[model samples]
Target: MVELSQTLLNLPVLICRLRGDVVQVETWISASGKHGHTGDWLVRDYITGETHLRATSSRYLMIDKKTRKLSFLKEAWADQIKPHVLDCHEYPIIMGDNRKLLQILDVDTADYVRTGLSPLWNDLDINQYVNYHIKYISWILEGAPRSFLESHKLSAMTVEYRKECGRESMLHNLSAVSRNGTSATNSTDHFTEDEGIEFDHSLYLQDGSEVLRARTMWMPKSI
Candidate 1:
């Protein structure tokens, strides 16, 4: 009976029926082994199997067919999705390994999509998520107003934020040291030199051919 139920749960027909007044869509991520992060962000209209968006972070060389000249584009590309973003959001999370994972949930899709079946968001890695978060935050905080950073007793806010990020999160501790010249509380004080916190962070390039040290682990002073 259990097997039957699960089988039914995975069926297109049942999924369709349960979603009678709604759009029925499901997304899956093909798991890649622990060598590094690998996958694509793909969303399709379930019933039609029509791909709505597909994006990649890989660097690519494009050739002009007529001129036979090649140009390298180092920046990642996300086709058919950027225009849908309605707002931007960022937050921090602690993954199972106690590593700090930053989430940048870009609110994509029109307002109507929210009224219907919400567009699916899936198949993202914790590391990739953090990388994007770092990039976005670093850009937005550049030359931010001092008044904005200190508007709400930011020192206190930073202290509480670090605690929620997880006691063992390396980034959180480093951020603390940068923010206050030491950790704000006893729990995160372990991230200090006296407690021997390691600050080295390196990430593999998109094609996995090279590694680079990230420079945005620290947050804005106002944050």
Candidate 2:
């Protein structure tokens, strides 16, 4: 179980993989409590130590598999993991409450919509829920326009999970809208750009209930 799920946010620069390039990953617990703990990952070049990507995950233990209810960390387990907790210097590129951004994009008037079927495999985590990373990939494959994908590359993304689905075939109804910029929220400032485009995504089930909501930014392909 997790809150906010695992979100990957990219920096302004494009991340490229080169031959013979060695990379290093460092991860630590950024926050912990009775409910859950937040982990952060920093990926960088081994030679120059230049950061390539950053990700954060809010995870919790499941108390009941049937109900998918979360459990608080036990005293002994929390104590053992406390030694590994470390503060993070770098933060996600996309920050703050994204509820407003999700609200701003109307799925009914979405620029693109794609429908597909996704099945839950038995090999998934104990939670049996769809992985947030997979959901992002589905958004790209089903929601993004072909021309947009040809010219732009994903830069950053934020996903908020709503409901949990089990080992059944799910109707993936994904809608996407292109936006100029993000709206202002409590902690995030309003910003607009003339260049790069922002994409807001909403994924729904067959019953019209949302499975997850996400927002992503894409940069133009370099010549």
* Winning model by lDDT: 2
Model 2 CA lDDT for position 100? 52
- lDDT, candidate 2, 1-223, per-residue tens: 3233333222333476578889998877755345565666677999889888776555434355444555555667667777876655544322454555664334567777777666557425555666656654555456777897887777766666665645564555455555654343345655444246777777777787776677777766772
- RMSD for all candidates, in order, please: 21.7, 5.3
Error of 1 at 217 (Å): 27
Clashes of each: 1, 0
Q: What is each predicted model's overall lDDT from 0 to 1? A: 0.23, 0.60
Per-residue lDDT of 49-123 in model 1, one digit per residue for the tens?
Answer: 664443222112243333434433222322322243223221011112212332211113111111111111232
RMSD of 1: 21.7
lDDT of 2: 0.60
The residue pairs found clashing in candidate 1 are 149-222
Off by over 4 Å in 2: 1-14, 32-34, 59-63, 87-100, 104-107, 120-123, 181-194
lDDT of 1 at 189: 47
